[model samples]
Target chain A: MNSTAQDEITAYVFAVRAALGDLPEAQRDELLEDLTEHLTEVMADGEGPLTDRVGSPEAYAAELRGTAPFVGGFPDPPTRPNPLIELRDQVLPVLRTADVKVGGVLGYERASDFGRLLRPAWWVLRGYLAAMVVAEILDGGDQPIGLLPRIGGSDGVALILLAAGILGSIWLGRRSFRLSTWPKAVLYGTSFVLVIVALTGFTQADGYTRDSYYSNVTSYDNPYSQVEDVFVYDAQGRLVTGARLLDQNGQPIHLGNAYCYDDEGTYADAPEGVYPYCASKAPFRMPDASDAPLPSPAPSGISPSAAEPSDAPATPSPSVSPSPSK
Target chain B: MDTTQLLKGVLDLAVLAALRDEDGYGYDILRRLRTAGLGDVGDASVYGTLRRLYNGGLLTTYVVPSDEGPHRKYYSLNPAGRAELQRSGKVWQGFASTMDDLLRERGTA
Candidate 1:
């Protein structure tokens, strides 16, 4: 027989067998064998189609059972439903109905399956944009970037923009917007690039560094506890002055020298006869004034005046004052 | 009346009777019964009756290989089947007489 005919016959026989599920194996097999033979004969006769002559396979099986009463009565067929089928039956109606309702509103009632599948893609993109908006807001001072204008400083504008993007994406996903081709390309491409840039900025943010916003805030420690030794030395290593020191931020105590807390700290320019009380808490001396001309002191460590002219006398400066003028 | 139901009751007898003179396969027996005026007889009914008779040790079966088509399983009445046909025939005669009497009375009424 041609395979198609054979398959048709097999399907018919299987349906008959399924209907006769309550029969004993031996009896069912015997009946099926006879039916097969009979069907073959009927097919050869060509009086009519098998189904036309015998009715449905179920009815035929039932008639077969009606003839053989000696075979024990058929039991009720068992009911075993597939779980995936159960889930699909329960879930598909709600999803399909939603699709239909939304599709109607969007005038996409006849949209292809490809368009329907695109909803999840839009949702994912919207989710990514939403995260970026949140991160931009949490970062506080960093400006939102992209083709869109800055919506102002706070995350509030970013938040509103994010909500708009999400809603717009959802509408587009549902085909309600049905944006033009170029517009969609521009919007998605811009958003994609913007999300990448925002991610990079978020990873590199270091706004919480020490000098930021907290630069001049004093420690809560007691002024007395904060005081330390404040001493000044001349280029020849002679002691210029001594007093109680203040903290680096100048909180606790203030010595006579205004140059102490200068931006250069220990490197401040010493007046002709006076020593510069360094802002740095570490003890240090001035740089050598004996050099061709005195150089401004560096921000850190003893000035070269103290280190270079160590072998010289304790003259404060030959041009400015006499030797015992300490 | 649904003679098909009535045929069901006598289908074994009819099928066995069809094979009495000469052994025939399932379709051949079906043709013989239809030719005998049991036109309402179901194909499955005749085929089932044949299988039942064979299983009841009343009929013997053999396969006749056909080069023209599929092999045919031919059913013939064994000695036991012949005895069954004789007994069943006598019983059917008595039942037919009773039914005839009842029908005649109904017709007159």
Candidate 2:
């Protein structure tokens, strides 16, 4: 028998078997016997060739089983429901759009399965670009040159660092954006670290300037006579109060017997002006001069006035002053 | 109608009528239909109608094993099938008479 015919016969047998499942065993056997006998007799009685008259095994089986044969030509058999259809419908649209955008990044004219494989690199490239944007926004003002003794001028170093950071970010971004997969992740991560470093460097430079101003103010014991709280310590590290006063050059100006008092009410008498008074309470606000050239400190042990003036202002003359009467 | 077309509609009824007296297989049914001047009836049409009627609960079928060739399926009408045949036969008779009346009247007119 032709394969198709055989298949049809098998299908007919299966269908009959299915329908007969509800029948009692004896009835089922009888039905099968009857159909077989009938088919055999029909085939024998055919005047022409049995195949031509009775049809193929499949057609014969279909007719015997009461099924309609192929009317015009065989149509594809009805298919079972596909479970993936729902998921495919939902996911395909988003995937297609993403493929378009990512394909452009990868320099592809059309998206294909091969192009989709580059998605990991595309994400990394996006990350790198984001980092570069952040870094651009964060670049800040120059550092104070007065803070670092070895690095010399802060302006040059700040400008150089800023330029290097900008160039590095651009380089990393370009490199990452060119890639198609996770290798771009490395570039993105590096860009992120570079941006963080640049921000930290700017912050540290600002902090150094503030700390330098504080140090300058603290160097003077007392520029004004207004009393301030003083933390005085004895030789043994014992806390003492009422420390003496001094100038910005650290010179003691007063002489008297003054008693130092602890919060516990004990008073220890010392030479009145021996202890240095704290200057923190006297708010010595520095001039707002971010643009002014910083005044370099005088040589190690030299007094401010005695230092040779490289760019200091001229001193005022006293020859025109009036004499005071006794 | 041509004998072929006429036979198509009544083929099921004719097969049932033939099996009314005794059970027969495919070849026996074909032989009887031929003898009855229904030679124009295709062999497939008869066999197909037999199977259809059997499936439709009008005819009961049984296999008789043969020593020489394949086992033969024999068909017989049960009570329900016979009653159905009688009812359909009556309806057909009525319709045929009506058609005959109309055709004769037309002819005379």
Candidate 3:
């Protein structure tokens, strides 16, 4: 018989056998021993299908059983079903229903039919994902991912690997169904793991895109990392606290950290353009400052004079002379 | 009345009679019976009758393998099958005549 004819005959026989399931095993086998051959003959001379010629398999099985109850050395009827057979009997209906229902939702006769159509697309995708794993391994996973993996930082290798991977994957996909049970199981396991690896690789690739898109805002090689606060000084060389620095176009000059703690340990925010983020932490000292401004030539003689006129002209001369010369 | 219900009673005899003239496969026998005007005789009924008669030692089967595809199983009536067919055929004839006479008087065509 042709393959289609063979398949139909096989299905017909299988249904007949299943319909005869209540009979003992040996009895059922005896009844169906010549079924395939018989079906082949019946289909050959029929103008229509085997079902149209013979009727439904169930009705056929009933007619077969109607004859000779004691002919085949019948054994006692089956006491209980084999566990595996029981499981199959219970599960087949639900699975068949799901196959039809899911298939209907997908606009196919069966879900497996839809799955068969997607196999080639999956083969290509699986090949690409497999190549990514290889590239990641070859590159030691250090390089940032691009549109395609550059194994060992070479575009040529990436293209070759991609072609080989996709072709090889398609080749394997075509033959996978024909594999023996054990090897097929192994392939299924590896396919699942490859899916997980692909998900992780895509997530990392997404993060890389975000980093490059916002590179100016946050960069690992920032030049001003050590600058905690900015302290502006005028040409007179006196510290200008609360000095807001702006660019030539009058845009605020934002640099350095803008937050600090005062001497009293109170938190403060002196956003950029307002230089000297913390006045108390300024690099330069003013007249009568807490650090005494500088080493006084006479600690006792001038210190009291400078302190008495805290805002007076005497502190300015002392503060100015020392700053310009030093 | 359903001819299928009637065919079930005489199917074994019909199968034996079909095999008497020439040995035939399952489908060949079905074709012969249909050609002989037992159009309502089913495929399974013939095949099933063949199996039961074979088991009862009244028919024999042999396989004829073809070069192209699946083989054919040919059934032929043995001596016991021929004898049973003749016996059943006579009984059917007697029943039909008796029914015919009873119906001819009681009913109009």
**CAPRI grade of model 1:** incorrect
- Using DockQ as the yardstick, the better of models 1 and 3 is 3
- List model 1 lDDT by residue over B1-109, tens digit each: 8898688778877887898899999989989999999999887777777888888788998999987568999898999989888877777788889999998989952
Please tell me what DockQ candidate 1 reaches.
0.21
- Compared with the true structure, what per-residue lDDT tens digits does model 3 show for residues B1-109? 8998777667776787788889998888888999999998777777777777787898888888877557778888888878877877777788789989988889843
* lDDT, candidate 2, A225-248, per-residue tens: 233233332222222344444555
Residue A105: error of model 1 in Å? 99
Best by DockQ: 3
lDDT of 3 by residue, A1-326 (tens): 57788898899999999999999998788778887888887676547777887889999898888764633222324578689999999999999999999999999999999999999999999899888888877786566646575776888988998998899999999999899999899988878989999888779879988988877743465554445666544433346567655555666656567787888889977666576677787644567544444334423332334334344322222122221111
lDDT of 1 by residue, A1-326 (tens): 45555566677788999999988898899878867666777777765556887678888778878777652112214668889999999998888888777777767873445476776776656655655655545654455443232344544665666666667666655663578888878867876776786566555554445445575444443332233223444554444553333435644443233444544544454442233344343343345434423333533443435446554323232122211212
After TM-score superposition, the amount by which residue B50's alpha carbon in candidate 2 deviates from its true location, in angstroms, is 1.8
DockQ of each: 0.21, 0.09, 0.23
lDDT order, best first, reads: 3, 1, 2
- Can you tell me which runs of candidate 1 are displaced by over 4 Å? A71-326
Candidate-wise lDDT, in order: 0.65, 0.54, 0.74
lDDT of 2: 0.54
